[model samples]
Target: MDANREIQAPNSGCKHGGWVTLPFITGAVVGLTLAGVGWTANLIVYLIGEFNLNSIDAAQVFNVVNGGSFVFPIVGAIIADSFLGCFSVISIFSCISLLGTVCVALTATLSSLRPTACNGGSGSSCNHDHPSSVQFLVLYGGITLASLGQGGTRFTLATMGANQFEKPQQQGVFFNWYFITQYAAYVVGATALVYIQDNLSWGLGFGICVAANFLGLVSFLSGNRFYLHDKPRGSPFMDIGRVIVAAFRKRNFPLSSMPDDYYNPITQAAPPKKAFRFLNRAALKVEGDIRSDGSIAKPWRLCTLQQVEDLKTLFRIFPLWSSSIFLGTTIAMQASLTVLQALNMDRRLGRHFKIPAGSILVIQILTSAIFLTLVDRFFSPAWQKVTKKSPSPLQRIGIGHGLNLLGMAVSALVESERLKTVHDQPEPTPIAPMSALWLVPQLSLVGIGESFHYPGQVALYYEEFPASLRSTSTATISLIIGIAFYLSTAIIDLLRRVTRWLPDSINNGRLDNVYWVLTVVAVLNFGYYLACAKHYKYQNVEKEAAYDTCD
Candidate 1:
């Protein structure tokens, strides 16, 4: 077998020096995340403060930008799987990201690129001056390029790092550290970078991001010789397409009950299992399907039983995947709105240090990082000891769904209280009398839910997806997040048109009603998730067993 084929094999040996590339890869992850989140964390504030956009418009822009960031990872994953491999793609996009960050920094430094300040005002009283077309295009161009670069690098980097390890144990360790680095970066970006932007200067803050991007690119390139480069085989998506086409073409053919009748690449194994049996016809032998050399002559007309089975596995998991979309949508909407809420509430901590509105998100990232460690270190093992089996991915995801619903409920209650405080104030102040810390409970609950579901989703996809699509499997989370953000934007826009729930000044609008709607949607989504989870079956039972053992 060729190198690419060997790499794709389940039992492939590690050719490169194991763990040598870990530090470089982890360093790059931290740097890239720092750069990416530095801008993204404070994006809404930047749009409102620098671009002079209204609160609602800024939130919408933030969602769209975040959605794009998530969407581009699928493109990156496809490119990594089909054309340029992960290392090459990461290298190319890293450079692109650095350039984009530089452009963003320039916009902050050069006053001409951004709109004038909103009459030097602090909050709702600020004048809402729209950016000129030229200014808007430049700003958006920078944001777009930066977002694309971030999308291409984030999950693809994880897959590339994981590829260096042959053992499942070591791979698990790498993933733990991978997420740790990512969340740590988010905490720093949300708190430190945001503080700098709010206190010092946007130019200085964005300049730091530019520096981090450059450093990350350099760090990634430095580990070039140590990395095990997985070369691009054809796109896995193409194989999925081929399976569907072949299955449909053979719809009239009858499936055989005997193992010998169906096409199995491995001579020793039994025929594909009974589920989705209609698809089994694609693997049924027909005259002229095979060449004299035993190769597939008409690839589109005939597929291996494994291909057919893999397609079925994807189909089985899709409803589960679809159900997670609304979960993410709720989180996305809550995150954007929480920042706005923080901006309106009293954000003081001590005598001198007042939290930045953008920095309030750091609470969630910090909670997730802490809880993730606790779960990995203590909770999983403890659960296994009590139950005699580690918790399944579906169970963990279900727990996440429940916690998410609770978080939405808490958010609705908090918003209601904040609105009451807003109404009770004798005079209209820029800030509400309520403390920003009230948002922490909902944010922390969301974080804890993430600690369960994010890893569960990644593990489920990685375990269930075919080896050929391993990289793409990891990127699937990004795809869902992207879609959810877009959906959230649409939902927000729809609400604005139809209801009084989300307006420019949330204090003047029924913001709590929006959270209540989300809570209801989340409850329905959880029901859908339960149904999907109960019916779904694992394709690789042995792999899941091994994963459980490793945990």
Candidate 2:
């Protein structure tokens, strides 16, 4: 057999043959679309200045527009797991995202047409700002629609992509390539977006996004035939109930350990119910279960409360995971606020060169790729040989967070240097813009931390949950992340309020203080995560052969 055919044989449940090309194509297209969205969003801030808006108003507008993405993933996950299957969910959402892209482009076009449509009056309070309430009503509607699609796209596509490769050994390589490609998109998208926003109009920037999203949609739709469609199991509510009922019966049923009638359906005659007295045992409390005599029968005996509590043990570990939201938010800043920070940096690469700040994102992307490749190819195997035990994903999380904390510390040092440079150098041309090179160490550290943390965290959440609650579990992780964003903002706000005594030179528009705050937060988060890691007892799902996975 050829390599492709060999890989497909083991994954009997997944349809891998004719559909292999579909996933790779879709992944690339999706990458382009996401890059496009990011580029357009960043361009809006620059475009807003053309409307005569002041710094604060412009910042608020940008925050509101970007922050709109926070809660939309929940909606996407709900629809995907419940009503629409993953494929349909992706299609519908991708299409809606394209609509949002169009709206963004139109908003820029319309602002040029009638700035009055933003605000009612003048002096930066114009009625026709980028998508006013009427426009916002339209814009937000599109955003909401697109968010639903985009949020679930990663979760579903990654899973579907993995499904395309079936061989046990190939699965590892498949996921490795999958993550590598996704991050590759992040790098390409970030780089391309930086270039586009610097050179193009906001309308063109967003118009490009629209095209990219449409391409993603096309790639997904075309591969519909090759995907293995696993119908989602029924609602957890019913399944949970069934499990409880069965557990209770197993405990309380008077059937005892007596050999239950064993029939070989292929060879034996059907045994009469009367053959086994245990069938009438009173302990079997299965509701509505009936006997052949039209009499009330039960499923089995009742389970002890202690038995139920045994299953409930997983709930205890949740608080530890949930509390990490604070950490998630701080880490997320690498994507959100870090971009803003880069934008504010002295972008002049040297005396004669001016590079876009967003280009710094490439540093992050490349670092992640290099580290991930190293871990899979070198580090993981080396560790396995030395310890005679593979590193658990949870173990990796603790280590990842430590690196993340160190990365934050490096960022603080970089910021301090920048602050020192601005204070000491009075000249307009201060010796090659204070060496923008300092940011490399910090950005590279963050990239390494990302490689350690993100993929492992994703796998951790899914693997830790009972199969029935995978969606709910993953959603919980997302919720923590969303909550973290709010918490990070709150912490920064609180710190700003407390530091109000500082002079503008040290405080205003300078993120040096913010770096310190993040540094402190990361240290505390890392410590907390380590403590949780020590106590966490990973579930051994492989050992539980007969247990119902229905929540």
Candidate 3:
């Protein structure tokens, strides 16, 4: 089949491609994201206020929830690639999300599902009642369903939307808009829904989320007739496994210089590159390996060169991927800690208005959204004009690493200043006199870094991955983020056990030390990333040109 050909949906007259599906897809993305982020952004606050959890416990729960949300995408992606396609997976998850949101809304409306409010005191000192076992079960059940829904839909939607377009340039445009919608939705959720929850009522806030989710699901279904449905091509993981087994079986086979010595399913393309040469033995044909018709007779003993090359692609990319894990860890830590910092700091913008601690993360989301537009529209084109070629994914990622380090440094400095304010007070108040605005610069810097790396990583994975693993390619970033969030939780636990840097109360803890530690880690990770990028060669140089042309 031609790569550009669109697969027609059964019993649908709507033609694939053009602007017909974009609006509906974009609308669904907006609604789903808005609903998902609305509840999650204020989760720590919700736990502390309604469930009467401690600061540390709330933060840990938030990290775990975020981790679960990201990690679930891998499962969703695999199901899409191996059985049901993206549309089916998304529809099922959307319904799951609605049910979860409804349950959460009921919890807010029914006092029995939440613990009584704590009396005025430091969260550490307050003798607050914990949620009952029944309450805990309901809360966990709601959040678990919600997290699974989010994980299934988030990156899978991006892949689905991109699949509608055949041209890589068109797909690139779709990704830019997809991220723009995602971050913009985060800004709204963190700001508007958070304010409603903080000021009006939790029930009302959660009700809004339920409505948004319903709308998303409905809008997605309404566009089913127009979608280009890709049929499942079986499990990519199994192919990878076969390659490993086949290579081991032919361990003693000597590599030959001629192209014909190795099996090439597509005879026209260049032979597999020399990198990871040991794996090439898997494609080395022996007597009885190929039948009369040129297909493999002993599947476990022989494989096509493309299969071996696909496995090698994963090996080449793993180092770069692993290096990104710590960068994500640093960002996750900053996200959770900044909220705590805001909770303790003076959050008032003026006499009439005060910022919700949970909403402070909106600064990062807003900055990322703005920078994404600028990069897509201005910076990339400007660079191309001067250099005669667009910035490569590795180069964009390198820039992101530099900015991420800068952001961490800024965080350390701001924390140091906040600590100084803590010490200078003659009598400490519950909230410090230092303004929360001091946290904005660091968040903004991180957002700018994200603008560079997030899309770069997406484009890299989509272009490099095996055709059968297209959906999984986009979800790989989600996997990194999920691991990072889990690692962030582990790191926090270790800090609490071993050092005084991450006490429940940020006022007395050496929070500055945490940021400094993250900064150092970022520096080391960036060095490792540089080494990986320098040594790497593009597996799909022509496809990379398509991305460059789009940029």
> What TM-score goes with each of the models?
0.92, 0.73, 0.92
TM-score of 2: 0.73
Instruction: Provide the overall lDDT of each model, using Cα atoms, as 2-decimal numbers.
Output: 0.85, 0.55, 0.84
Query: Higher-lDDT candidate among 2 and 3?
Result: 3
| Count of clashing residue pairs in every prediction | 0, 21, 0
Question: Of models 1 and 3, which has the larger TM-score?
Answer: 1
What RMSD does model 3 have? 3.2
Q: What's the lDDT of the predicted structure labeled candidate 3?
A: 0.84
lDDT of 2 by residue, 212-287 (tens): 7777777777766666543444333343444355544454444433322221222333332332233223323344
Q: Among these predicted structures, which one has the highest TM-score?
A: 1
Could you arrange the candidates by TM-score from highest to lowest?
Answer: 1, 3, 2
Q: CA lDDT of 349 in candidate 1?
A: 87
Candidates 1 and 3 compared by lDDT, better number: 1
CA lDDT for candidate 2: 0.55
* Candidate 3 local lDDT, residue 24: 81
- Candidate 3 lDDT tens digits, 189-253: 88999999988999999999999999989898988888888777666887898889998998988
